[model samples]
Target chain A: MITRFLSEVRTSFNPFSPLSKTARTFLAQLPPDARATGMLIKHTILPRTSTQKPLLFVKFKDGKELKLDLETMRSTEVMAEVDRHSRILARKEELSG
Target chain B: MPPRIRLQTRQLKVRIYHHQIPSQPCFYASLATATTPAPPIEQTIHSVSPIARFPPTQPPSHKPPEVRKSQLHREYQSLLKSSPLVLIFQHNNLRAVEWMGIRRELAIALRKVDAELAATGHKDLYADAIKIQIIQTGIFASALRVVEFYNPESTELPTQHPSNPATATLAHGLSRQAHEAASDRKKKLDLAPLLSGPVAVVSFPAVSPQHLKAALSILSPSAPNFPAPKRKANPSYHEPAVQNGIQKLMMLGARVDGKAFDQEGTKWVGGISGGLDGLRGQLVGMLQNVGAGVTNALEGASQSVYFTMEGRKYMMEEAEKGPEEKKGGEEAKPEGEEAKPE
Candidate 1:
């Protein structure tokens, strides 16, 4: 996953819900020092009885925000969706620097 | 043929013995004494008890018994059974140094809690028993399933083989019975979703919310009640490795008293005013209040009845006394006043 371009991440899901696997895995996939390098990660845990869908919100370095519903999405799919925007940012950075 | 026989007798030489000559037997088997014959296979098989093939401790497992996964499954089952409170975490590529730092800080915080508890005359310090350990996610989930679902004493075990009871006596965590019981997909565990991707667990021997609060403060600190130790109070907690490790570790959820709880629920458990004793105290207080309310209600009804009865008795006595008391007072007070009434 291209996490370098991500500036902020907000995730909310019930840990007991099976659909929240993607959201949990996405959080796990972040680098250990993702927070130290100016990345903001905040995850909220909904209660067990909650019927709300799992959500992942990401803010890229270029101010592009992506809101994802992780209900049916796998972790790989979530990563692919984020990387689609990140690859462009990576190209832009390479060209400029 | 006659010539051949004569030649054999001619070539033979006879040897003379010095003492009384004794003839030795050609076969050694003839000289040996006879012993009792062995028992028949049928009698032996029927009479003897079954011999145990495997060791007493290491029972045969559904999976390969010697593998690390099977052993871990057994260990995890024991862990789940022993500890009523377990906090699960997702550790993302934390280094050795980071793990060490985190463990060190955790020990320090837990020991401090223990010391405080000791000062207040609390027994059963769990500072040494509580620890954070990385686990194989799949094995742990299987173990959790076995712990949750497999009830050996209650359910009937299938006949492995009636002829040989030695092969199928065990109902341990890694046994076939446990595997079958836990294999049902229809019955899902609430903790199933949380046991994924580099999982670790912190198990407590008992559900002591004070210790849990201390542990949560060190590992996954929230702002209000479970704030991280300040830099000045404990500078080691602020080290880069520990901080980075703490940042990477996401508090997934908890399994408390066999029930799965989310992050909020876990915090609520830790936020319990006191440990089990405190919870018991609260329960006692609530029950006492209820008792008091019930008694007060009953007293109110009985008191009202008593007041009504007293008023009735007063009215009855007053009616019985009638005008006798009034007549006596009138006679004592006035002689001319009696003449005024016609």
Candidate 2:
């Protein structure tokens, strides 16, 4: 049963598909801490669902792709997150200096 | 309550006396004073915003969730005393809209700083620099939780998973635990403050020359010092329509202290600091314990798992005991522990 389930998951996963490829490229190419990143991703990625959009993606420094939904993209909450990251980056730079 | 108006100045009378003899002292006590116009008994009524009249509403005395003032100040001073100053702009009391504008302005100013340094043949001095950070303390519950991160060099904004009302746990411990776990992850990267620290807090309705000057001063510490810049003459003062419009807009609501669209003033509020890492760790642990409990409860509730407070608490207790029992068995009798099968 476990082997069958693994095979099913493996068969379903397709990075070569247009949507997946686009998302992966978007995540990799965009710089961190941009105001336009969310909007750009939303517009660029075509939603599969008729009702609403699915999760967007962002890449971290270590090349980790984090999922963010439409609400998160539009929310002013991003300001707080961005501000926090800047401080951390600043601290890192300071320590390195 | 009707706003109270205060009289600005008192009327005064002056008498002029020419040289007079002792007996006829009043002889030259001038009737000439009558030629002088009476001091205008004009009352200049300066209207004060009602928000200014009353004290800011204090958070509950037990403990406010925001960072403390002293810590921010300490951090700020320490940064300042360093070889190169870390010029931080701490913003509190900004509404959502004003914060957006200020952030944009900050980005532009940073770009301009780079340009100016390069233009002035100070390329080498660019290495000796200023680190600019803007901290927002208003509107959020936890001071340590970073809502957003921006880098001038970066092309995109990085945000964390936003808190949602639906998924939010009712249990204070569990909710706090989740927040701490998340905040800890942010803090480890130095994105969030390690503890509440002193911050140079300022309130300005919009970005102006003063902000630029402050940035410039910090960015080029070796530059010639000039006398403090004169306060800019408010154009609204000359234009009554603009002033009236501002007052009307302020009255419409979302006034920061009842004085909305206040493009005139800037002030430094006190310092504020973030929470401790240890607190975050404890909360993270609690969150894990609660999560395990919730999972187990869900599994056991094959018929129905009610996500009520009591049910969650019961699960958490159950979850808490399982780990301890496992640990005890393993420590007490390693062979027997291995022999036991599910």
Candidate 3:
């Protein structure tokens, strides 16, 4: 299961691309339970101005919307953890299949 | 005396007495006449002489003028002393707004990422999406800090989570916890003297500066620190509007006072330090604790994930790979040399 998870994560698009090394390090720390619910989505209808950066609008399984920046550990770590969990789910699905 | 003697001898004596009357009447009368007006007359005539005129009025004393206290000066001094520290916290509203804007952007980013992952038919993407959403919620909560301090009487602002009920509920819970924490801190510290009349404590959302300003304006409409709310209309017309506006305002900022509910649309932003240096210190400490708690919670949440996953594995792999790679290169070098020699 761990090998499968690792393989899936390795092939997955790098979550670190948009994040800084520090942010990536922080993202690498999130717990799996933090991924179950409380997802947020930040939305920007238009491209950001030079002064501004875009935000993510997330919706959780419980129907919560949240806006977040990609730069911070708060967002990145959670993203990383979610990525791991989804891979585990995929591995389970593959086994089932 | 010669004239009295002549009176007895009528006409003959009257002529004799008239000649005798020219004589001085008394020596004492002559002496009295000499001394009477001499000194004042001499002094009046010779006025230029130093001793002649009445003693000169003593030169006006050169005592220094009394100094007076100025209220403006005192206020200026206080401002100078506290400006550096206060300035950072003064922008709390602005910081909150910036955070909210960031959160909004993040939410959009996560959604895009999530969509991309979903399109790829990758189950692994779901976790990333969920994680992004959670962070977005935290940012949103930070942004809503301004509305927490709105005045319900003057302006009707929406709550933080009007659009998203689930996040709003969580924000509300967090707000309650913050309030309880503040109250606990208040209890621990002596604030009785700092509280005046009916204690009104305003809590502005620290999510964004604009929200905090809006909240502060509700407390003091013309707070120099905050920009005025642009919209004139009450923000809380509908239930969702009220809920979201209030939550937004509460999440953004709040005013805490017994009279907060009494004011029509005004939400209370916490208390202004009642010029009591000690209470201000305590409140500052409390605010620091709150800020620290938030940061610590975020750190703990992030760190928990860091230890669990590839982070640990990555470190171990790096440690193991270092020596093996070096040894492999060295062994391969000898084999290459032997092949060349043969």
Candidate 4:
């Protein structure tokens, strides 16, 4: 399931897409254990032209892209934190029954 | 000879009594006196006397209390100058709807900052920013009108007062104008489609600073729906005209009866003419949309069902009547009534 999710992410991943640089950086920073199965989701973009932040698109295992604002360090940090939490949980479960 | 001896003895006795002769010194004292021959009594007295009588010295001088107090005062002034006080301006003239949008955007931005701080364990810094007073400016007229939109917390100076009541009123009126202009811009954004998503339209009257702050505070994505303003006794004069105009325009497109849009359209027009004094037209527009959306959704569903049920009932009634007509025709034939051949 993990391999299949990775393959899907690889297929739809556009390195040069018009996402925020911060979002791209966050995606690149995803650790080996961070990958999860999901659908590809597009980010929701605000209409304001002055907004310089890049929106983030996340693909869930179900193939849906969740739109989020990833331009801010705070938002990106949250995502990273959540990933870390999930990794910890997975490790703990593996160690248990 | 006898007489001379007697007189001399008498004179001697008288002299001895009159002189008050000191008692004979003790033998030991007499011996010591003779031996020392006098270390002079003056020398002994001088050796026994202690040193005395130096002129008194002056006390050490110190700074005056007034000088010290003045120095402290100067230091305090300098500290005050360097550490500026922040004041937040809450402008009241903005419609609540617009204020809500601005508030949400600000909350999102602040939350983003807060989250970053949390990640880096800089929560203390985030907490400090949250405590800062957010000053909102009231509606101002004149050249200073643009300053109303500035972040009150970021402003360094106080706003200048109007010279007279007339000018003050003008400034207030100008702010209202600016608010209307802002609403006009939002009006162009097709909000109906956006409503289905996470985005919401928050508005405020540009005049009230407190209302603006409330709007900003709750504009976050995580924040719950913004509260509607309390109903006021006097209807806003501008609300009715704008609502009527919009209603007329909407009527031109399609005719709707007994639907949410119709109800909203009526209420909006009525709200403008007779409800909520000082209400912003843009707010009325928002309320109308909200009310209409809910009404339309329910009414549309019910109408769809009603039409389907009515059509089925009509069809069934026709089907039942068909057998009766056939029976009547058969009865007429059996009775042998003269059938007129046409």
Candidate 5:
């Protein structure tokens, strides 16, 4: 998971639902020092009877926001999508130096 | 030279008589004529108790009993069965320091509750037994299945076998009967979904709302109902490590008395005023109110009927007096006539 390029993360999911596995996995993969390293992370846990799907929002350092549907997507797919944006940032930094 | 070791023919004890043949098949049959005896007389007369092949404490298990996983499964089964209240949490990448701080704070809070309970003469103090422990998710889920689905009565035989009956009647959580019951895919548990990932549980030996309130406020604080301890009251709680640990932990749900509850439901349980005793008091109050209402309803009907009768009698007296007053022009005449019963 390419988390260096991410600035913010927001998610809301019902833990009782099986579909929330990815959403929880995404949170678990974050570095322990993510907050100290200037990344903002916030999450909301829905009740058991809720009909809402798990939602994840990612904001990159260059002002690009990605909204993901975690109900249909897997943890690996989520990481790949985030890494796509991070790879571009990494390339630009290398070129500027 | 003659050898001195040679045996003399006269000294030999063997005697051969080819003319006399024995009736038995073997020559030794005449010497071993005793037959094997029958079984004990008591065993034949009465049904004997079945002897267990294995030790009473350790029964044969479906899975290997020597492994750590099996032991943990048994432990978790006991945990689920014993505790009436279990709060589940999802822990994310928390360091050891954070867990230590969180545990320390939790212990302090529970101790505070124990002190209060002791003051009021309540003996069911579970402060020492309650703890937040991380578990093997797969084993815990399997154990939960066994706890929820397996019934000891369903596997028991009507009559014990004459010998080694213990092997046939194994009803332990790790036995083949339990595994078969729990492994059926059709049966589902309400708490199954929350059993994945790095799961942790806070189990209470008994459901005490006061202790729950304290644990919730420390672990996941929501204002007014369950607020964080004040800085002045508890300085250690406000430490950064505890706060960080608390932040990473997300409360998933609760299982209370085998019933599943979400976050809102968990809070509702914690919000119970007082504890079991408080709930009992509320029930008593409601019943007393119902009793009072029933009595009031019955009394109201009779009272209304009585009032109606009194009103009608007063009206009749007024109607009778209307003409009497007109006939008796003087007031003194009316008073004297009334006294004379005219």
Candidate 6:
């Protein structure tokens, strides 16, 4: 099953894809450790199929990619989790500064 | 020694010379110390004084009484040039010296003295002493007037008497004209904004730190919100009175200064100097913008050197050719000239 997933990701992956612009910028801002290891599996619209939500691929340094359900990502739970993480990050930065 | 009574306020210093003789007795009070050595009294001039609500506690007096007297006399001498000795007295009763009542009566007498001085070509007498006498003969009370005091100690004598027919008429005429002019001017004007006063004259005697705090607390705009800090003497804990006083003073200053104590705009409606936080924020924001602009400019410095040079040359050419040339150019375009947009 893991082999099949890897094959599927390798086939669909496009580094120069239109959606990659925003994703790349966001990844650039991440800490060096997070950029190298962490995966942000998001379901967003591609340039070719802007009308429909597609399974978008972003490659971190790590070989294993976390598979995210497109429907689940849009849920209120994910938004709340993101907001909480952002607040924590901001507090950490404030303390460190 | 001679039943001398000294009354000192922030500005006025009253030294009652209550002599046995009512006619010859002199009542002297220093009007104002308006010169150097001791500063001018802020409370006397401005309604809105920038004095600290709770001033620092004065240290205990250690100097000898004689030293203090001489020091006071020296201070008075410094003020004497600007504010001369005012003689205020009451007839029939030499012993009774009503300081407050005498002050009121003397104020009226000074106006008359000023009129007389203006009449006698003594406009240059900036700090001349005005002698004021109050006589209560019977039930009938006459209009208050100023008279020249006959002091045997001083060489200067009154050249013109207030009772003199010619001088009295002139003084009366001058005073009437002055009142009429003042009334006319007052009718034309409505209200004037009182500016913030100078640093208050922190003098000793009568006006203490506690008195100042109380007065300021009563008059201060922030007195309602902060309310004066209550002193709780906890016997168990060694509460330093000096520290407590300093802390209270700091709090009062912060409250009066407005932005130091509270970030919330609930307390004071900004002082004459304005809110410090807002000012700091503005300064920070301005500096940040300037820094960002400089950074951006430095980054793009290599991109447009040629265009900047060309622009400078174009500006010089435009400046050299006067408005006439521009008008001529606008009126009729030459074949070589490029079409210019309005």
Listed in order, the DockQ scores are 0.69, 0.01, 0.01, 0.01, 0.83, 0.01
Weakest lDDT window of 10 consecutive positions for candidate 3 chain B: B84-93
Top candidate on lDDT is: 5
Global lDDT scores for all candidate models: 0.89, 0.33, 0.33, 0.34, 0.90, 0.30
Model 4 agreement with the true structure over B1-342: per-residue lDDT tens digits: 356545655566644355776988677854575444667776664443333222223111122324644333333223222322111121212334444444443444445545654676542322222221111111111111222232234434333233322212122212343334333422331111111111112222122222223322322111232232222621231243322221111110001121112212322332342123335666878899999998999999999899989988988987897788778777777655655442
TM-score of 5: 0.83
Residue by residue across B151-261, what tens digits does model 1's lDDT show? 998888764453575656577878888889999999998888888888999999999999999999999999998999999999999999899889888888899999988
iRMSD of all candidate structures: 1.6, 18.8, 20.8, 18.9, 0.7, 36.1
Q: Over the stretch A1-97, how does candidate 2's per-residue lDDT look in tens digits?
A: 0011010000011121222322232232223222222222222322222233334443444233444543334323433443455456557667999
Each candidate's number of clashing pairs is 0, 31, 123, 60, 0, 0
Q: Give stretches of model 2 more than 4 Å off.
A: A1-97, B1-83, B88-90, B124-342
Stretches off by above 4 angstroms in model 5 are B1-51, B153-159, B163-166, B305-342
DockQ of 2: 0.01
Cα deviation at A42, candidate 4, in Å, is: 39
Candidates 1 and 4 compared by TM-score, better number: 1
Ranking by TM-score: 5, 1, 4, 2, 6, 3
Candidate 3, residue B114: CA error in Å?
63
The weakest ten consecutive residues by lDDT in model 1 chain A span: A27-36
* Cα shift from native, residue B202, model 4 (Å): 25
Candidate 2 lDDT over residue span B181-220, tens digit each = 4355444322122111212222222222333344333222
Query: What are the runs in model 4 whose C-alpha is more than 4 Å off?
Result: A1-97, B1-281, B329-337
lDDT of 5 at B63: 93
Local distance difference test, candidate 6: 0.30
DockQ class, candidate 2 = incorrect
Best by DockQ: 5
TM-scores, all candidates, are 0.82, 0.17, 0.14, 0.18, 0.83, 0.16
For TM-score, the strongest prediction is 5
> How accurate locally is residue B339 in candidate 5, as Cα lDDT from 0 to 100?
65
Q: lDDT score of model 1?
A: 0.89
Q: Which residue pairs overlap in candidate 1's backbone?
A: none
